[model samples]
Target: MEYFTELFFSGLTRGSIYALIALGYTMVYGIIGLINFAHGEIYMIGAFTSFVVATVLSIYGFPLLSIVLLAGLAAAVWSASYGYTVEKIAYRPLRHAPRLSALISAIGMSIFLQNYVLLAQSSEFQPFPELIPDFDFMEPFAHVVGSSDLVILLTTALVMVGLTMLIKFSRIGKAMRATSQDRTMAMLVGIDVNKVISVTFIIGSALAAIGGMLIASHIGQINFFIGFIAGIKAFTAAVLGGIGSIPGAVLGGFVLGLTESFATGYVSSDYEDVFAFTLLVLILIFKPAGLLGREAAEKV
Candidate 1:
């Protein structure tokens, strides 16, 4: 029981990070049907940005919590700028082209960004400051759960709730939804489709930035190449949950996380990625629309 309990928390912690990144993947796809492959690179940049911020703040001996919060803000804002630039340069012009063109552009941009970061920062792995506090409340059950895990879970919950509320109640949220469902019709109804798309990119990038910052802090290390693998897994999560569904993305994240955890715990760590990708393939084969995804209508 204790082993399973530990595994559960571990999976949830990982899933929380994946959920954040997957949300970014799903939002962009939902709004424009384009997979922003460069998004994972954006996440990498965010982690680096936060690291720079925290490092500078640490020299001043600020509170741990203040450093964490400020680091997150800096990461989000900085990465959001990259997101906007990505959309403007890589995706926006290709929007009207064949879908393949947009996909290739994304791939090209992903490569460009990866190399750009590698050159700017060292190719070596960078360590992140451990800002997450280890809570004493879980000391008795430290074998099963820890303060760090609790923080990850709570942070994810707060982000999910806040994002849901924003999408459900805000005027911008409605516009986003309208543009996602039907771009032409949304523009006809007076919504600025381009603005909505751009905002969507910004929001998605910010979410990815947060994920990158939080996960890097938790793991204590990051590198320019981490984004490639993480991006693939997040994209798989998006597909598993139904790419366009926000709730589905979260569900898929947890499901995929649990799958990886159990695989590593009960089986071999070497097979973790294999197991995750296999599960995604099975889900795709069995339910093409995804667990929570709706099938799109085709106008022949």
Candidate 2:
């Protein structure tokens, strides 16, 4: 039972990060029907943003809490700019063109950003400072969770609740839903689909920043290349939960995290990736619509 509790909490922490990243994937795909392959790069940019900001702030002797908040703010701002610019440069031009063109452009941008980061930062891993200081309050239940993991869970819960409220009650949320349902109709209704799409990118990028920073803090090390593998896994999570469904993305993230955790614990750590990929394949084959995804019917 103790071992199970350990793995469960660990999986939940990882899943929270994955879900945060996965939401960006689902939102972009839902609104634009384009997979922003460069999104992972945006996440990488966010981590770098946090690293630089936190390091600089540390030099001035700021408290850990202030440093973490300000660093997150800086990362959010930087990633927002990247998101807006990427949409304009890489995706906006190909909106009316073939999907393949947009996909290719996204891939090109991904590679470009990856190299750009490698050049700007180091090609090697960088240590992430302790953003969330350890606490002994959870010492009694160390096997189940710790203070850091609790913070992660609380942060994820708050973000999700806020997002749900924004999507369900806000006017922009209404426009977003309309645009995702039917762009032509949304534009006809004066929703400004393009603006909606841009906002989606901005919000998604900010969310990605949060995920990146959280994961960086959790792992204590980061590099330019972490985004590539993380992006691939998040993409799989999006697909597994149904690409266009926000709730589905979250569900998929938890599922993937739990799957990997159990695989590592019961099976072998070496086969963790194999188990995840195998599950993806099986889900694709058995239920292509995804667990929470609605089946689409197209007319010829």
Candidate 3:
């Protein structure tokens, strides 16, 4: 039972991280119908940005909390800029093009970004310092909630809650919903569809950036190739929960994370990736559009 408890908590922590990143994927796809395959690279870039910021601040004798905050700020800025540029350059030009063409462009952009990171940061893994200090909890059950785990879960939950409120009440959020429902109608209603898309990208990228930082901190290292599988997993979570549903993404992330963790714990760590992928397939077969996803009815 203790071992099961450990796995459950561990899975929740990982799921929280996955959910954070998955939010970005669902948000972008909901708004534009573009997959943004390069989003994972944005995650990678954020982690690297955090790493660099931490290195620089360490020289100045800054505390761990201060350094992490600084890193998050830097990562957010860099990811926002990158997302803006990507939408403007790669996606905007294809806005009116066929879906296949836009998808091809996204793939090309993803490849370009991957190579860019490889050239800039190298392919090797770089170790990172632990941002949160470790301490024993007074309660015996506290072992289930390690410092890093607490941070991941709390940060993700807070961010998710804030995001839900933003989408529910903010002016831009209304515009986004308008655009998602019908771009032409949104434009007629005096909303700048392009601006809405841009804002969506910025928000999604920032979320992914935070996820990257948390993941790197959790694992104790960052690498150029780290985004590949993580991105796929996040995308899967988004799909599992209902790609266009914000709350769905969060639910799916936790589900996938918990499942993967327990599967690895009991089934076999070596086949963890396979198990995750298999689960995705199984979910898709039964739910089609996803657990929370609504099936679109064809118009006559």
Q: Candidate 3: misplaced stretches above 4 Å?
A: 136-143
Screening candidate 2 with a backbone cut-off below 3 angstroms (N, C-alpha, C), the clashing residue pairs are none
Write candidate 2's Cα lDDT for 171-278 as tens digits. 999999999999999999889888999999999999889888888888898999988988888888999999999999999999999999988988999999999989
Give stretches of model 2 more than 4 Å off: none
Clashing residue pairs, candidate 3?
Answer: none
Clashes per model (N, Cα, C within 3 A): 0, 0, 0
Which rank order by TM-score, best down to worst? 2, 1, 3
- Comparing candidate 1 with candidate 3, which one achieves the higher lDDT? 1
Residue 208, model 3: lDDT of 88
Point out the worst 10-residue segment of candidate 1 by lDDT: 141-150
RMSD of each: 1.1, 1.0, 1.5
Rank order by lDDT, top first?
1, 2, 3
Error of 2 at 212 (Å): 0.7
The C-alpha TM-scores of every prediction are: 0.97, 0.98, 0.96
The candidate that achieves the highest lDDT relative to the unseen native structure: 1
1-300, model 1: which lDDT tens digit per residue?
888988988999989888999999999999999988998999989999998999999999999999999999999999999999999999999989999999999999999999999999989988788978777777887778777778888988998998899899999999999998899999998999999998999998999998998888888998899899889888889999999999999999999999999999999999998999899999999999998999988889
- lDDT of all predictions, in order shown? 0.91, 0.90, 0.87
